[model samples]
Target: MEKFEFTKPELEETEGILNHLRDTINDTLKPDDELRLREQLMKAIEEGHIQRDVFGLNPVLQALRTAQIAVDEIGLKRDGVLATLLFPLVINGHQTVDDIENKFGTSVAHIIQGLVKIHNLYEKNPIIESENFRNLLISFSEDMRVILIMIADRVNLMRQIRDTEATEAKKEVSEEASYLYAPLAHKLGLYQLKSELEDLSLKYLEHDAYYMIKDALNATKTSRDAYIKSFIGPIEEHLTAAGLKFHMKGRTKSIHSIWQKMKKQKCNFEGIYDLFAIRIILDAPVEKEKMQCWQAYSIVTDMYQPNPKRLRDWLSVPKSNGYESLHITVLGPENKWVEVQIRTNRMDEIAEHGLAAHWRYKGIKSEGGIDEWLANIRSALENNDDLQLMDQFKMDLYEDEVYVFTPKGDLLKFPKGATILDFAYHIHSNIGNTCVGGKINGKAVSLREQLHSGDTVEILTQSNQKPKQDWLNIVKSSKAKAKIRLALKETRAKDGLYAKELLERRFKNKKIEIEESLMSHVIKKLGYKETSDFYKDIAEERLDTNTVIERYVELRDHDSGVRQAESAENFEYESPNEQFTRKNDDVLVIDRNLKGIDYKLAQCCHPIYGDDVFGFVTVSGGITIHRRNCPNAPELRKRFGYRIVKAKWDGKGSSQYAITLRIIGNDDIGIVSNISNIISKEDKLTMRSINIDSHDGLFSGNVVLMIDDNSKLDALIKKLRTVKGVKQIIRI
Candidate 1:
């Protein structure tokens, strides 16, 4: 890599941003490391072709600003800073993974690569299904810094969105941020970022609602300030008397959050209560933090009537994201509800900055806090088999967790609504495979029983019991489902193999080679989608051997051009010993010799060579062949049984029979051309004519084709059915 010199104007802007970033992290970063980081940032900007606009705001400049925010606000380290700086180059297609890894180290390069993969997934599958979204989280789990950088990047984008002129683009970005990024920020415990992202997104997505709430909040600000002062005065005095050093602040809810409450409650803005919260941050040592929080909570609840249902005591057991607070909703003056939150100063920092602040404040690299959560997610991803990878990832990321206890009193957490079978599998696969039922809280229950928090479950197992296919539907965990599917598939594969051996034996007795080609032919003729399905039917005795033999013979004979034909021509009575040789052009082979007999095909049924037929002697015509299942067959057969004559085809030569088919489909442009293309691909059929009519965006057409046999015609019809815009096809 070569270092490029920046122009005087570019150098000035770059130096200014770097100086601000250095000052913010002067205490944290080593002096030499700071200089190196500055050099790397300057080089990346130059190589990336970053330039300042008339207002001195370019992509590179924006990236620097994001880096500054990540350090000063988000509490990120060196790797995160590098990621923020280089993410712009990756997004704009200016740099590759190799370039980043060679110029920087693997740590920074890997983060950028993961971010790029996520970006590509979103771009390629914009209407991302839940499964793909889960995969996005799994990508995030690879490195915690990836998400930190992403949040910082989004915060900067939301801040600059007012400069965007495209209304549609703004709406799309805002909707995505609202639906995905904001919830993610909240889940990660970054309350400040979550609030900002939601407010910015609402400003774009629901402009009217956002402004209305904003204006309402502004109008009430003066009165709200007065109320807050009055409400907190008593609590502040009590806390000061308790000798607790603390700072209190009144926090208004974001406009977006207020709008959400209004919509959810189906009320006007003024009808909503508790639009703001009061926070009491105690300056306490680590040992006294929990005690100080509860003390504040008691003081507030005593001064006002507390809602029992709304009290959340996280001091005992913090959230998975390490959020610890004591929250209580109280009825205050004027019968209005006010939510009060109490936490120590350290807890407040963790709430604002999330995992980064926790790690920085704790001074540990890989600890038991967030790393444990990441480990569990990785474990699920590694063990998953049947369920989609994204689904497993989503389960780990976003699903509500229920904590259950084992018989030994060991607590285990699982996704809410997990069944007893999921519990059994969580213990061990063998235990699940042999599980019959379980006892929840010492009461007998089926495996399908949904476990709730704090329930003690004991799995009952039988040595002879194996997993059933239906267990898949009963279990909610991906692990149990994967195990059940694996067991069933193995059993089914074995059965299929046995069935194949039986079929092969029968084929050998008939002196026919049951090769792959022959198997494909038989499977298709029998209407089986897969060879395994055909074999399974045979092995399970669901298919009759005689039916299989008959179909096989038919397929073999068809391949050899030995079609068994039936005739519908009648002849005058002849002597018992009489015999006659007929020309091969005769469509039907008459049982009785009928030399020079004047006969014609029945116009009503238009019997073809492959059709079943019988002869009917007409008074005017010599004889006419009528199909067995023809519309007039029953009447004719009942009226004149004696006049019927048995007939058969010579089965020696081939000739084309004209057939008309009706087709209907949407009237799309070039639909006829598409149908014609399919017809041209079939070598066994000759398209004689076609007529199409289009009306009201619908097309109806009749196609006239000349085909050799029923099989060829059937194949042609199947092929035509696949053409684009073709809805229906029927032989007329």
Candidate 2:
């Protein structure tokens, strides 16, 4: 760990931060609360707890700065401030939650506990696969205050590390701040803090881009200010003439945002317009906030041509995070498009600091919706099978909201790009679990169909249509993805148990006693990651029970040494289905090999005329041909090594073999008709049987065909692949 020594100037700065923290929390605290517990927190940190962090910064000072950010910058209350101060003590085990709760209160203690859980989960590098990171994200979300404090803490860390010598640590912190916390801050409506975090993160993570944008901003500072003055002067005059009480100002966009626009637009800094936005904060009554905002909007548009496409009306329906603003882009002087944001003073505070400030207002906080969204996030993290889901979930934190209607005309908000399946889950989990498809605007649509704004969606479901594994790919909402995974996991478990029972019955029919350890080895050798996965494949009919039983019997007999060989060069041993041999010619070309050896192609693998084949010497002095990847290949090669012989296709290969091919596609008459037509068109290809079953709009079937040579087989497979909606076609 890199250590930072406390110097004179650093100590002076720490004192100032400490005083600022105390002053910010004084108004929120009771008369005796801060004087009593504040001293206790600092003393505990000094005497029992860690005096310095991994970076050797003074613990008390860092806590004060973190607390100051939470209280002053984030607009968190006394509990949030105190929890930020007390977290270091609890995380270090010097103070317990009970002790803090007795002195500070339940809210403070709860927040402190949450903070400790998160702080303990923090590592220099965190892998999303680990349960720790998943828990870390989900735990803090139960309380929105916790997420705010965490963002504040991250901002404090990012701000403090710029001059530190810990380059690698700085980069990790910067990356997390940029990728994770910035989105979170934006979601919570802390735009000022969010932009600051993004700017600092870019400075550390992408040094060149950060500096280039900054330098270009500095280079154009004079002209940008002049243009802003010219633009704002007219808006200020028009709004005042209309007697709208408002103060207007122009602020440049953050360096990070500017860089993003440059990259997105594929241009240099100068090539990008609208590098800054104008804000008009109105001093208006609560009831007239919207009326005055529009009045001011009309005043501005009267002077400047408003770009109707760029207008965003959030005044009527504020964001879930309590963000209220009217955003529009108007054509100002010089044919330039300038963005303008208009909101009330109260709206401005809520916009800048989020619902934390809205908590003080009457009927302004949208905690219920934000709470439900966070609950969905928490649910998604539990049993998260994919680490990429966490990244997607984080990006989902601030996704643009899409407003759509249900069949009953109820309006619902979803993340943009959410599909019909996601809407089903959004309504109810049972609906989502059994969802097959939907009707959009009274038209039939698949579950994968993306919902558009203003469309009426009525989810179509069936009790028999449970969530399939592919449902995970169809939904865009985190709630839908998480619920699908849970459903699939439960279904897999049930199938695994049922398959185990079936396997036991088959084992009994074979009269084989299954040893637990030996069965484990068998499943491992069969290439299963987990025992459940082995049984699941059986339940899904991906594996044959007869194949498994044969494997078990082979393993049992091998352990008993019933097929022991004296030597590879002289021994001739035979198992039930395999034979042994002595050395012969290096290759077996079927008809040309030995001229007197009779051979039979193995029925297990159904080796065709043109297959990459091999030969096994039989007890009757004949060879059994088998394909290389035959199910029994491993056992044959392992036990009867001396009998193995190299074989390959030769000459015209006019012989025919019966092959079974499994085909699956959409359940359409034309699809099946086209496949049948193609097979009948090919000469020398006879379709013996076509067995198909249709269910849930999909058709799956197997066709046994007598086909000559692998060339013909390859051609048939290619033609079948070209069939529209045919998902898969493979020979069995």
Candidate 3:
């Protein structure tokens, strides 16, 4: 390949750039590294190319320069390699020189975010993911720079491949370019890169097919030129006569596209006359360009019959990526179907360059409008779940889009097939969660209903509605799903808390001394969102008091014996030898008083002794001890607070304790009677609770029992949570 020779003026510009680079590097680099960088630059100049792209990222070479110097002098962190990638942005600064650093910082922050997104690709390939827009949004949320850098890298690599060795390696790169990178380039509005990527992808993936197409074109070179001339003659004459300034050029579609057309439609070469399209570049104001193009279109249709269905009015509704061109297939001289695309120069540039070119020319707004394109990048950064974040990028940022509308006529672009739930969420998360119904074009609709282009949706939401777990199955957008899941989890927590509070009040009213932590544990066990919610459930008879007491007793039986202190002096904890006794009435009596320490039951695992137990002291929420059998106990032990308390059931006499038992048995007429009779006769307690439910030939009965502490409760639970013919028994 021939090297590009720099003209005198260009060389002067290059010299200025070099001087700027020198000054910036001098200021930014350490003294020792500066000398080494100069040497590297001198060597690079001698070799030509300067080891830099147009953007001047000579990172690997710079690293060598940096490493040759003492690390302490430069004081660069290993991960700070991202800074090198951001250097190009520094030179193009606005206002104060501080703006340089600020933009540099912003760009570096975005680049680091992009790197994080790129790391996500290792977990799942975004191209193959179902939710392209979600994935795209996730990527964008991290940093739009990631997508831009990826585009730049891929383009540079393609150019390199075209002029380098290792054909097989190029082919692999080309295949990836075709399948993933090219489409991305197209979406980004990088027209030149998009075409080059497509051509390169085709060059390798279907070498034989590409060569055949090339050969066909070469063979028809004379006739092809003649055909285009003949075809454009009338249109040109009419436009010239009308005093319109327009440029027309014939463009053959890429080899890959032709191959795809043949494969997809099962057509031969001759059948694809419209494979080569003529582009009419109108020289006019942006507003008048489309009108002039349409008038030209009318003339062309009049001159030759056009395929009406094949005509695409992109000027009216541009692609989400900002590709705008009017396409129409018209009959040619030999009755051949010829395609024509009409657009203004601006539209053409946008069609080629996507969002980057727009940003370069128009500049992004402060609030970051739709054109900002980095909104998705920010979201990816905010996401902590690696897999989900990656998935979000693939779905929201990378996918093809459908432009819909709000009832008020605002354009809402969403991934294709976005559900109404997604639409609601796109408007706002609160709207999505409370959305019980929606309407497309004034028709009431289900939340799961898929949306289409031009659909004007009105979401109907209830003020008091809460998110349901079932919504996770139907909501399309990951944003909506994530939000719903979060809301549901929160609601359950609040409900659990409410239930706990209600149980505590009941204990107080009954003059029954209750462990505050134990009560909280019971509420958490019930999956309530808060202590208040737990109380509400209890007040509404959704929670039984006896079951709560039995659960507390069981928790005492297993975990009442010990507490442990942390070795870290900063972390204050009680020694495991310390013991706390609670009466059956629920009053906590510490046998060994420990200073600045309190214990409570963890709601996560309402620690019933038979269930397994552990204690955690929350700073203000109080100490929460969970049953060892409690699902959350293990997790609470691992993270956050780790204070545990030694406790025992030292309550005197036959103290009645509440315990809930689930009985699963064969559905029968006398099941309730038999269970009630046993409870009434075998125990000294009356029926405090009885709930019978039958499903799939199984009768599951919940029975609340009053027993003498944990030992008797455990024996009864052993008989209940695991009754004969019982599929499963669980303490509620």
Question: Which stretches of model 3 miss by more than 4 angstroms?
Answer: 1-104, 116-139, 162-171, 359-732
| Per-model lDDT | 0.73, 0.77, 0.59
**What is candidate 1's lDDT per residue for 160-242, written digit by digit as tens?**
76767667666777777777677667766777888999999988888888898889889999999999999999889999998
User: Which prediction has the highest lDDT against the true structure?
Assistant: 2
Candidate 3: give its CA RMSD in angstroms. 19.2
The top-ranked prediction according to TM-score is 2
What is the descending lDDT order? 2, 1, 3
Per-residue error (Å), model 1, residue 656: 34
Task: By TM-score, rank the candidates, best first.
Answer: 2, 1, 3
lDDT of 2 by residue, 234-280 (tens): 77877887888888888889999888867644568877888899999
Cα lDDT, model 2, residue 617: 72
The lDDT of model 2 is: 0.77
Candidate 3 per-residue lDDT, tens place, 1-732, comes to 233344575557545644544443344434444354345335434555344443333433333332222112212222233333333232222122244235334544555555445545634653333234356556655545555555556665665455545666566667667766666555455667677777777776677888888787788778888899999989999888877888999987877778776664456677566668898888888668778888878878888889764678878876556668888888888778888888887777666656444543453322233334444323324553433433333354332566678878898777666788888888888898789889887778888787765567899999998787667766667887788888877887777676666666766775668767765676676577666665555655655565466456546555767444455543643333333222222333322343464654343333433333444554343555556455554444444333444344333434454667777766644667766765676565656888776644457667777665456565655654343345666765
